[model samples]
Target: MADGVRPMLMRLRRNGVHVGVFLLGAWAWAGGLLPGLLEQWDDIAFLGWQHVELVALSGGAAILVGVPLGILFTRPRFRRAGDIALQVLNVGATIPTLAVLALSMGLLGIGNGSAIFALFVASLLPIVANTMAGLRAVPPPLLEAARGMGLSTRHTLFQVELPNSLFVIYTGIRTALAINVGTVPLAFLIGGGGLGELIFTGIALNELGIMLAGAIPTALLAVLVDFIMAQLQFWTIPRGVNPLR
Candidate 1:
């Protein structure tokens, strides 16, 4: 009990620190530390909207592609193919995001479309790999029991395998989300609007406050999304399976 409690306490402390830092930064920014940045709040709001839209578009694509591919690969007929597929995905993941973005921009001619495509590719590996791992981890006896009970393959998959694997699957998704949020800023490089617009603009103008104005919001958005996902994970996971809960 003490061991578990210690980690929980530590996590709380870390969260407190994050909140403190965010508040401090907001105070500085609002108090005229950056003479003209406050005036750009409208631009910040618009860019933030773009940032979220890009993440949503790319993340949705990753999930749509990754989950089905993961399921298909796990089938008995495709086990070998699954192995090969995972390796290919691993290679895709290993490629630098900027390189992918650059290549995508060349092919798609820049803008949000290219950015979304690049981010989708970057986010796919984790979802696929995690889904595969989660499904594979299902106990053989549990599957046999389901079969003995005369459950249809489809029913068994949806009711038993998917439920059992959801925790790990969500972990992968959460990871992908984090990656997507962090990567979205790079969209500005390709004329795909995001907080990166402010950041890069700040760099060009040598204004630290302008950069912070962008950076703080981006960081906050990531944290907020991560927290929401964590809650979803907690609620979706079976109580029996969730040791922490």
Candidate 2:
């Protein structure tokens, strides 16, 4: 019991920085720094809730599209089609979020749907690329074993191949998520709205409480999202895959 308690205490100390930061922020807020932040409570609310919805929809879309596409890479024809996917994902990853917003503004004219479109485009390549890599990484012998067992191609994939590749797919999704979190800042720019608005407004005003209030929550939200993704990886990937490795 003492040994376990010692390690747990050490971990608490390591992560205690968050508590200190939050306390400092609470102090500023109580002291009446950046009082104007209280005025925009509605904006913060809209930004937080809508951004959550936006990320959920966009991230789900990425997963559905990426997983199946990864499975498809097992086909002999994948090589032939790889170039098209590469080009599409290259465009997705390379385009700036602002440029995506501009294109959407020209076409969709700015709304949650427009925001989703931009995020979807931003999210695809990592999923597709990682899926392909994971499928390719399956040891050739394991595939042969599946074949020798007389499994159909589809069976081999759904059962043997996909499981082994799950870790890779999880990694891809997590990376895309981190990218999306960064993109949340742009949502404020486009009127997709989120905590980013609060942070940006606070920064513009140079109000310590407002800045801390807005910035702290955004940072915490990113951490929260990252934590959820970590949970997902643990649940979906087999233990042998070595998440860290």
Candidate 3:
């Protein structure tokens, strides 16, 4: 427990800027800088839930596709093709997410479907990249040891490679989810309902209170998502592989 607390404290120290921003936002709210927020409690709750659902669906799809695709890329059988695929994904990731969203809107013709597709695309590259890197980072000796112990190839992967690599994979998921939370607001442009409704509306009307109503919650959600994923990484990673342990 002390080990965990130490790391968390260190992290907070390193992230003082973030802590300060959060505190400042809280002060603003308490000071009634966002009076409109109090009146829109129901909208905030409803839209926040919608925002969470969008993130979950998109982030889940990215993981389902990215992790396996990453593993395939790491395999000797697919090495050459994987390199090409990685290049493509890297390039795709470089394209601004808004552009991806715009293209998705064009193809899918608006709504939640387009938003999900765009977010999934935006989130895939990191997961795939990290998975491949994590697998490769596993010491070669570990693979030999597993084989010498009579572990089958599949068994070696599930019992050895994946367990060891989960920390890095989870980092990728954490990053992707952060991006998802930030980007989901753009979905409002396509009629995909979320907290962005208040944000965009506030922007057009130049209403600071309305804007903060959406922006503050979005920022808080990003922090909350990262914290949750970090805790998951701490608990799920093998103690032998987890650096924090």
Whole-model alpha-carbon lDDT for candidate 1 = 0.90
- In model 1, what is the error at residue 181, expressed in angstroms? 0.6
The C-alpha TM-scores of every prediction are: 0.87, 0.81, 0.88
In the range 1-245, model 2's lDDT, one tens digit per residue, is: 99999999989997797889888888867877636566656666777787788788887898788778766755787776875676777767777878887787677876777778777767767988888888888999999999999999889988788888888888888888777777866766777776777777778987566656666556777789889988878876666764653
Report RMSD for candidate 3.
Answer: 4.7
lDDT of 3 by residue, 185-233 (tens): 9999987888999899999999888888899899999999999999999
lDDT of 1 by residue, 204-235 (tens): 99988788778878999999988998999998
Which residue segments of model 2 deviate by more than 4 Å?
1-43, 203-208, 242-245
Q: Output the TM-score of candidate 1.
A: 0.87
User: Candidates' lDDT values, in order?
Assistant: 0.90, 0.77, 0.92
What is every candidate's alpha-carbon RMSD to the true fold? 4.1, 3.5, 4.7
**Weakest ten-residue segment in model 2 by summed lDDT:** 33-42
Q: Given candidate 3, what's the lDDT at residue 183? A: 95
Error of 3 at 113 (Å): 0.6
Could you tell me the lDDT of residue 79 within candidate 1? 100
Return the candidate ranking by lDDT, descending: 3, 1, 2
In model 1, which runs have C-alpha deviations exceeding 4 angstroms? 1-31, 34-37
